[model samples]
Target: MAELISLDRFVDVLQAARREHIALIGGGGKTTLLHALGSQLGGSRVLTTTTVMGHDQHGDLPVVFPTTDGDVARAARNRAVIVWRRIEGKKAKGVAREDCDRWFDLVDHVVVEADGARQRPFKAPAPYEPVVPATATLLVSVIGADALGRVIADQCHRPLRVAALAGCTPYERLSATHAASVLLHHRGALRAKPAGARLVVVINKVDDTSRRSVDELVDVLHGRDRALQVIAISRR
Candidate 1:
């Protein structure tokens, strides 16, 4: 198996350039990836959030709830900033997809968390989920290597949807084939993916125990979608 690449190299692999909108879907370290990319890209990057996220998800980045275009222009001057609508209790609600387009005029890069997984390692998107912006140039589908050998119901969000796509019951163990099925499924993690956008799959928590699973999953993905890039990493 290949060694885990550095986060900077990971960003390079994604080909994330300035003035591009990147939407992160699926589960397993989406927030971590978002911030890591934000930190790496620096300069005029706006994390235009879309899904429900925790209040502290941005760490120390200045957060701006842009009620007007002037506020957005002001936040875009910073090296890195989080743009959202408001914080409800402990969760931060993201602005609508239409509103996300407005930030492009101010910032160079926009990173959007398009789905919610409730801290689970893997997930299948529900019908009305993953609010990905149509203008996204990159779509990253994330899953955890640790999900291997565990029951789908125990470690996956929307386990029933996963089971349906994987052709198994919730209590069944999550095999590499099953994982591949979920990722490759049109309406699964890749839902609402833009036509011309680059698609990358990130397999997180790739320890010794999960290496084989990651490899198998990658093999399956390549076989099905030759253009898709599969990367294995240990975000922890």
Candidate 2:
């Protein structure tokens, strides 16, 4: 049943979450989830931004590099706004987390992609990775269900780190237990989650063939962290 946790539940979780700031971390599908949440939250004053992101991945929202509260208020008046500091080559640099904290009161919701995974389906974070905001009230950690059964060297964003966390060789085939090790590790996916924030683990890209492995993964996660909410979703 946990393997069947749907995207609809993911949306419902985000919709019910509060504190005006939601920060996304970990790997798989952060950007897509950010946009989807922003649209589904149905806020006219929703603000989407990233700690780091491709300059061209702004989705359809109007981009605003705000320097003042009035700047944000003016641009985010009655529409979704994408905020960034400046475009640095292929990447759009994000504002400081302090800026996000301040903008919390300026908008209905501020959704931030607080990590970068180089588009890999799965990842294990380095010490400085996952720049989650201190003010974030909700933290969403994403993992790819497809990473199971693949060679970590070929499938994970940071193979060495994943290997370190999972206690397997970099070239070893990944298993549900291997993925569980990272999810349960304090320095892994839960690295920077704020104490007051709600945490949800999202196991994404589920299909019929992946159900058993996904179920196994959920069982391991809950076995270790009874408070954790794990949501497994298939494609839209």
Best by lDDT: 1
lDDT of 1 by residue, 1-236 (tens): 54576565667766667667889998888898998788877568888678789988876889998779678777777588888899999999988887766676667788899999999999999999889888888889999888888999999999999999999999999998999999888888777888888888998877877877778888888888887788888644
Which model scores highest in TM-score?
Answer: 1
Give the alpha carbon lDDT tens digit for every residue of 35-132 in model 2. 76766664545455556788888887888887787798678765678888999999899877778877777777788888888888889988887877
Models, CA RMSD each:
1.5, 2.0
Q: How well does each candidate superpose onto the true structure, as a TM-score?
A: 0.94, 0.91
| Regions of candidate 2 where Cα sits further than 4 Å from its true position | 3-9, 44-50
What does candidate 1 score on TM? 0.94
Stretches off by above 4 angstroms in model 1 are none
Taking all chains together, the TM-score of candidate 2 against the true structure is 0.91
Error of 1 at 45 (Å): 0.9
RMSD of 2: 2.0
Clashing residue pairs in all predictions, respectively, total: 0, 0
